[model samples]
Target chain A: MDDKDRELLRILEENSRLSVEEIGSMTNLIPAEIEARIHALEESKIIRKYTTVINWEKAGNAEVSAIIELKVSPERDFGYDRIAERLSRFKEVRTLRLITGTYDLQLMVSGKNMQDVSRFVSEHVAPMDRIRETATHIVMKSYKENGNTLFEQQEAERLPYSF
Target chain B: MRNFVSDRAREIPPSGIRKFFDLVMTMDDVISLGVGEPDFRTPWNICESGIYSIEQGVTSYTSNRGLQTLRDALSARLASQYQLKYSPDDEMIITTGVSEALDIAVRAIVNPGDEILIAEPSYVSYAPCVTLAGGTPVPVECTEEDHFRLNPDKLLEKITPKTRALIINFPNNPTGAVMKKEDLEPIADILSDKDLLLISDEVYSELTYESSHTAAATVKDLWERTITLNGFSKAYAMTGWRVGFLCAPKDICDAALKIHQYVMLCAPVMGQVGAVEALRSAEDEKTSMVNEYRLRRNMFVAGLNKIGLTCHVPEGAFYAFPSVRGTGLSDVDFAERLLKEQKVAVVPGSVFGRGGDYHLRCAYAVSRKDLSEALTRMETFISGL
Candidate 1:
């Protein structure tokens, strides 16, 4: 990314709700310039999504999440890409990655509870036609996610001094 | 009527940095680059620890020297980071902030009628703290030619028989100047021959960019006479925690603790708990935070230079002390005019002391948007002038 593109992404990453004028002011770009740059970023898919990270447990959604390791036998032409694409199409799958080592793919799966996650894994994932083996580890807690903390924000209290 | 205040307190001058802030309060939509505070909140885990402490009934006073556990954490962190060792029990005292630590260190070291040489465009608190401690604050000029780094010869020129202490703040306050170990060796050489004390306020030490920070205490034999003060305020974004610590020789620490015990018993217990968490997990958090500030510094510094205001590449801290001489305005006038015309607020560099007359300090701690906006406004203001 160019310098301006990097700065624009950083600003949007911090607070995507900021107005075009606000972004422009911070980037030293005019409003039109900001609009054009953001438009370009969106078209290029550099900014794939703008979403808020919620403290879901606090939000009353006590969903159980797990990172599932899959040892898959790839189909001929596409290697792991075909299976990876199919797995990503599942609404329960938050993230999927093809890998090296003992595991072929890593999937972030979530459901209402432990039983729900188990059912999804046993019924849907484990019985897949290309399946080899699967190991699931539930995420008991999250310390940090997506550069954000799952806690209520604290009030700022900096001293009003230059030093 | 009773005369309440001490003569020492009365003699200390109020900070000039406040003047613009006062004006800013009366204005609307002013984008301030005035206060040198981080816009980032204290990291989540650190704050969580503080909240956890409160939930666990960890309220009440800690030891006058602060909690043993906290001090031990600090001691270990310092030892691993700087190779400077201190006994947690007797050689360290956790104060309310670097402000309080600096105050008591000055009070503990200075006798009446002594002189404390401070390099200028320094932190605003240094001179006032010296005066309040009944010592003369001698301002030694550090020009832009040296990138605001203290020159040993200029320091030597300011010293006299009564010069008992020298205060150095690296990754400095307004100038954002940092000194390499080699840049400091000659000053240490000059100081080693004297019986003077070195009060190194390294609160911004961790915020340094590119170059590694070398704590003054790590200099040859400088540890014996150096009082190194650091805090969670700048690095861990825990300014509200009011947690800071000083590491000195046992004798000096004991002396400072005497003042700390009477004036301020201990830092807040919850803050200490948070500080422990910071020492434990803040390495990665601070690294990322420093990286963000580095990007902002690059953008802001380049913007100022492009607009005809010459700025030294600030190697550390979050400030850009760009010279406003090209605009044909004094530092105060430039700041004032910028605030009035463009509604952007920055501090006049002279408020920081000598060799800062032609510059203004713009803190890049604001959001990237605000920094960009402030720079644009400043450019317009300067061009019109």
Candidate 2:
């Protein structure tokens, strides 16, 4: 039953629009089995929201993305998580990873253009209380983003099983 | 939102070699041969050109492809030295060093699930870049028997229908093996036959003391399928300047140039000036350094051999890849012991690829005095072990 949930999660990742029957066929399971597994996976928060994976370049958005590394200091009482919560409220923060390096937080922020990005950094990211220093790399380009996903068997081993 | 992560992110391990170096940095009296970079500063002539460019205010971004003069100089130098010809305007891009050129090469060509054939125990970037580009990195582990050269037969064995490109880096990092024309021709033919592209990194091209560097484009038919990456970093001692050029057919160059432009409007405008000067005035710097490196290479190899550490006489580049097999330890474990016990910092071969389990790379580009001290420390460390 857990293996089926892992399969359902993987299929959903590959194509969020996969129908119950199509997913089961792809995973070599019956439709009724797929429906039950998908329901369970979705209920468990493994399959989050179905998202439209648009190739932004092809979508005519021409949005310029930039990465800004921040050295933020949360208030004396509040910890880093509280500061992260405040920052994530901005619509532009795509992904933020609290890194273990010279910089405390690496923000994958993007905006329509340099002006919009600069506005966000100066007004919001930079002025945050206790931000020691901010280094903006403006991800000139990423030849490759991390595309490594564990194979299905490995994924199954990683997850807890009830059955 | 576009995915920030991909499937390959989870497949391979983070660079253990880099991690070890970070750990060893805190240790005292470690004679470390572990850092992969060279020891020299940018040549004086190159530095002058850079200063002059800044003084002249050539600071604004140049054309996306790069400065016309630098590109022409690179093309002329490549043709004169290596018998390769790429049109400066149509087929070259000035990038922010070979790192960026490599990034563009992988991104411009590879699609998800494609396979990248790498001659292992070679350059470190080939596999990680391939994984990041959503391609499978199939390492064709070259052995000490091959002097770490990519065997054309081995390359053929690694190719499947899904294979996309073969990454070739000669005067190779860690191993210092340079592939001569005679050695590369068969691989070129293979590329032609297989309809595969070649990402040839020859950043150390000028540093070869052996036969002349072989450009992949020197092959009659492989020019279209070859993307050549070279830089002033290794040969001209311009590592910090971060200037590299990528040359390929116009279409591929165009695609890479788009990414190059967006990423770096130009290779440090000053670095371009330095590259032009390095090509124009520093024939002596290349020869003199190669001569010094050859001397250091001999000293390093002999020292290792005397201490019962076996080595392949590195044909090019500044690294001496020697085996640590006698120590009864894994390459990583041996490197740790060496750094902790002897303070000799050399990168473990395992960081490069499999079959590197018994080896380590010692860069001999440091001053002869430092090299001598390092050798002494290494010998003492090994003897104690």
Candidate 3:
């Protein structure tokens, strides 16, 4: 909304776990100001839910993911919006987007295993009324996700002390 | 066997904190607040440009003054930022790093026994570099009372018939002090009366938090006499790439270039390529990194004060020099005891030179988590003391 608000967003986007006092110190704002600003941002839906980026494989809960591209015929009045809304209701769909270049819609979906994801695509996704064709590409690995590197980030190697 | 080392080399004392640094290396789990470099890697685009240059077989020695395009970009940047005009073809030479630039600037200007006035509690290399260039370095103490700025009277006191040059760095390394235009005007006035050169190390110029840095060359009547040295190390976090610029009057630059040509030839071609990209496109990345440093400085300096160590908010540079006198310990003792008891490594301020006693230089270039943890450990250590 403003430069200070943008700066606060950038800082929070980088590390949302920072305490109000810590964020206040960094932004040169008092704790009360930071609290009120954060509240306003949340109420305005500018500040979304704070979430963690977990490496599920490391946590021994590895999940299978796929990117589904949908080619759909527009309904008489509803167009792609009806089908998009229907796709969004699926809990397995982590992200849904209207995409350009050879796809009308893209769905990022994940499930407990490859079979589970395939079953969902075959049984539910392709049989939709307006859904004409479906293509699912199973993701093999995630090197980066949600602006975070999925691998162990390299530490800056430096001497303990230097001039 | 006869001593092989020259008198000049022998006379330059080893860093007093060498043993302390060695001790730091031997310890485990030490959160170091002692480094003088940025923690960020070189921006991705800059690195990609360098790699692309190498991949495309652009690896060859650049002209003795570095690539023309980089020099051109630097010239335009200087002119636009400071209104200082320099010919890229004649008045600029890219060197290995600011370290090399400073070394050549000193060698090119200093004659035997010509005294060079260096502000104390400065970067450790300044005095030694002057001595290695066959110049006697006179220390002009910048005290805490003066906010570690070089007072004009002090500068005047140090100048003499033999005084050949004065070297100044702002957004200074150890003290993190900066000189705004008003603060520098008096020093410029003093220099205007003397037949002295000014070697301005502006490597930390972009790191200023409160105000934009004032280049010494931009000061009144100082341009003709000032040798401005800067590089991509601090601002762009490309220290390992080692690209630096030296800009001055054509005659001074010519002299420095001759030495650079014979000794170093040119900066690495890949680095020069990366530098061109950095100047052309890395503004956004540089700004974000600087903003991160500012945030860390505010938080860490406040944390230091909150923990009862009196620290002046550093207006520039990454270090927070706080007085450890209240804890009844010398800076060296403070550093050593803190390291041994708390696993936190900080540089003792006395190693930086005069007016640094009982002070500890803590670099806030580390992450916020590490800084917070280090502060907690330091609080426990101080309370026990």
Best by TM-score: 3
Q: Residue by residue across A76-152, what tens digits does model 1's lDDT show?
A: 99888888888899999999998888999999999999998999999989998788999999999987898786766
Please give the TM-score of chain B in predicted model 3. Answer: 0.98
Q: After superposition, how far is residue A88 of candidate 2 from its true place, in Å?
A: 82
**Ranking according to lDDT, highest score first:** 3, 1, 2
Worst 10 residues of 1 chain B by lDDT: B15-24
Q: Compute the interface RMSD for each candidate structure.
A: 4.9, 25.7, 0.7
Q: Candidate 3's error at B23, in angstroms?
A: 1.2
DockQ of predicted candidate 3: 0.80
Off by over 4 Å in 3: A74-79, A153-156
Cα lDDT of model 3 by residue, B1-385, tens digit: 9989999999998997887788887888989998889999999999999999899999889899999999999999989877778899999999999999999999999999999999888889999999998999998999899999989998888888999999888978899999999999989888878878899999999899888889989889899999999998999998899999899999999999999999899999999999999998999999999999999999998899999999988899899999998999999999999999999999999998888999999999999899999999999999998
Candidate 2, residue B94: CA error in Å? 0.4
Q: iRMSD (Å) of candidate 3?
A: 0.7
Candidate 1: where are CA atoms >4 Å away? A1-86, A89-161, B1-6
Q: How far is candidate 1 from the true structure (C-alpha RMSD, Å)?
A: 6.8
Q: Residue by residue across B231-264, what tens digits does model 1's lDDT show?
A: 9999988888899998899999999999999999
* Candidate 3, backbone clash total: 0
Candidate 2: CAPRI quality band: incorrect
